[model samples]
Target: MGSLTLSGRTALVTGAGRGIGRAIAIRLAGEGALVTVHYGRNTKAADEVVTAIRAAGGSAFALRAELGEPGDVEALWDGYDRQVVEHTDDTGLDILVNNAGINVRCAIGDTSPETFDEMFAVNVRAPFFVAQRALERMRDGGRIVNVSSGAARMAFPEITAYSMTKGAIDTFSRTLAQALGPRGITVNSVSPGIVDTDINAAWLRGDEEVRQAAAEVSALGRIGRPEDVADVVAFLTSDAARWVTGQVIDASGGSRL
Candidate 1:
């Protein structure tokens, strides 16, 4: 199971309280990386994840910071500085997974400025800013995996804004891979299809008709679980993926066809 060995490294995962974020954080810790689970506002959820990681005999800690805000980013960095630098002395972060994002379901006609701003803030701007911060502390061989979605390419009537943000992430990842190539850092995006998570349980697994349609259309013949996507993300953040960068691996069971 530990094919992607991240032993002796440190990882920071954003929005790691629940759903896909939590899955990724747990997987990274299980692979022997010291994981810091970051949440937006869910203290209890973050603590639960930390507890689970600890129970699995892995090193983990719970951190909270609001996504898409400069103040929150500073606070996060300060906390990381105290906790990580004091322990490691070197202060170089090994892995950063930008898995936090906001999805707004609004058609073009119904979209408001505030809603658009909010979506872009968390989905688009936050990743870029976080990546910038990560680069400052990342070593030469650090890995950055940004969580994207098939909606970035698939045209959905009510998810235009959300798709735009994801599209930007795809582009951002590719561009960053090139920018950080000389530094030996890899940047890639993992686009998941319809994943069965608490956030979208009703759409992907609970609703019989929706599940049937997704299964019939997908080549894998089933909806994706959080662990399914989490496994791929964990791989991309490992040494095997060092040569593979600036690419988007679709973990969608062939759904974007």
Candidate 2:
């Protein structure tokens, strides 16, 4: 490969205040794209990302939005339109990484309507709306990457509802891929396995027995990291992956088969 340069493009990454979203935002910014770092809460964390990106000599700005709210999501894009014009030469989004999501660890029997609704609102509905609006501004040959999970494929206990949303994202990616292919855009999903993110630190790090069991099941003999999954996402969003679309690649280190 010569180089995967994104010098003139712009990308918006939601839930980019920390963890996998943070890593993906940084990775995209590192490739030379001006980035809009979106967060739901914790402006501090989002600013930290802005500081880190700026300190690394990359262009980035922190923007906030409550993903489940329609107005907030609209402000996210509206803010992006103004930010790009104010900060960078580009005026449109070339990449949309729908990484903002929530996980409700509720089993089938214990699942509540409120819990299920909240999860879907953040994980499924929000991303759908984001993509819908983004399409209007995205140029030809745009890229859309939805962060999915291995749970979507496996029948894991206590996470059935969360898994349902992930499966929905995968299907959405596929359909969007076909719908946008004519426009020279690519849509895909990156389904990460049990990665060592703050969201799962309790089971992946806090419990030694569970940690060991997780590692043993993985071919890599260790837990995955934010960067591990981010690397795959970066590739999918790059020119090298131009021919790849509607595909879900597992960045799980061989977990969940």
Candidate 3:
């Protein structure tokens, strides 16, 4: 691919403050897309991502809005519209990465109603509404990538609710792709497994035994990195993936196979 495959395009990555989202933002910016780094609460981390992008000669700015709350989608887009107008004098977006989601590690029996509701609120409801609002601002031939999980396909009873949310995302991608096909827009979901990010640090970082267990889950026999998933996302947002839509591409390093 060319160094600036996405030159002059505008992209927004939710949860861009850190982890896989951060990697996606940086990668897109490096490919010459003006990026909006959306963060929920970590102002410092979000600002740092913007700084890193700028320092790398890429353009980016940070926007903050906690997801899963009342009016969260509107608040996020309001900020996004203003920032995009100021930066590019356009209110349309070229790429939308719905990467923000929360996971609650509880089995069905142990999961409370409150916890279940909260997970759906953030993982399912927020992304659905965010995409609904984003479609209004996305330009023709735009790209939409929802970050999902391998747990959605394989049974992981420990995070049954979280897996359900991801399954919903995959379904959302398929239906939305058909709806937007006339506009040449693509909607797809990516499922990653056992990535070594802060969210998994508690178990995967210090304990060698736990780390090895996680690694062995992947056929590659190694822990997946944030960039591993980010690269897949970057490709989906590029023109090369124009003919690809409504598919749930797995970035799981052959996990469970």
Candidate 4:
């Protein structure tokens, strides 16, 4: 079997300051990709990730842009362009992982219009625009992996808006794959189940009972870890997944089955 490596490639992973995004950035760097670690507001966490990568003999740098805000996508690429000029002469990218997202859980009755708009803006609009602009600098045979959630496939009325946003991402990936196929670019989505991250710590890690209940949702009988989702994303970003595109790979550990 061939090994997975991203030597000589450049990758940009959004929300890399912590959680799944951080894990993804580190994993890609370990595989030898020159990584751009993006953060929304946590520059320190992002810098720490970059420092760790560089200390491990990998190349990485941190970029900042708050998604869901006006002009966010352009600001992100502006940083990317500047960093590319400073780090390498190449103007193309090899991988783009749209891993940044927000989840606001509320019942249909409690979901306000403001919250609904914010969720869609951050979870759907940001990624869509990011990919649209990224294609211009993405090389042939490059990969785009959208981080989706099991909530999109299963019913989660408590987080209806959040789930809806992920569904949109799945569609975006499928349609984009068809659009970019002629250029040999692959776009896919990776949907994960309940993962133990800062985002879910409030509930999943709050009590043993809650944690175990979350774990039981998966056949593995354990709450998913950020690394679990990150590894799947790494595979999809690698050339090994070149033949795979426009598909939503479930990294959900047999949830909702």
Stretches > 4 Å off in candidate 1: 1-3, 85-87, 202-206
95, model 2: CA deviation in Å?
0.6
Better by TM-score, candidate 2 or 1: 2
Query: How good is model 2 by TM-score?
Result: 0.97
Model 3, 1-257: lDDT tens digits are 32338999999999999899999999999999999999999999999999999999999999999998998999999999888888897888999999998887889999999999998998889999999999998999999999999999999999999999999999999999999999999999999999998888877799999999999999999999999999999899988888899999999999998
Q: How many backbone clashes does candidate 1 have?
A: 0
Candidate 4: clashing pairs of residues: none
Taking the tens digit of each residue's C-alpha lDDT, what string does model 2 give over 1-257?
Answer: 62467788889999999899999999998999888899988999999999999999999998888988768668888778777788876567898999998886778999999999989999999999999999888999888999999999878988999999999999999999999999999999999888888888766777889988988767888988899988887887788888999999888899856
Candidate models: Cα lDDT each: 0.88, 0.89, 0.93, 0.93
Runs off by more than 4 Å, candidate 4: none
Which candidate, 1 or 2, would have the higher lDDT against the true structure? 2
In order of TM-score, best first, we have: 4, 3, 2, 1
TM-score to native of every candidate shown: 0.94, 0.97, 0.98, 0.98
* Local error of candidate 4 at residue 193 (angstroms): 0.3
Taking the tens digit of each residue's C-alpha lDDT, what string does model 1 give over 94-203? 99999998776789999999999998999888888888988889989899999999998788878888889999999999999999999899999999988777767645
Arrange candidates, best lDDT first: 3, 4, 2, 1
**C-alpha-based local distance difference test score of model 1:** 0.88
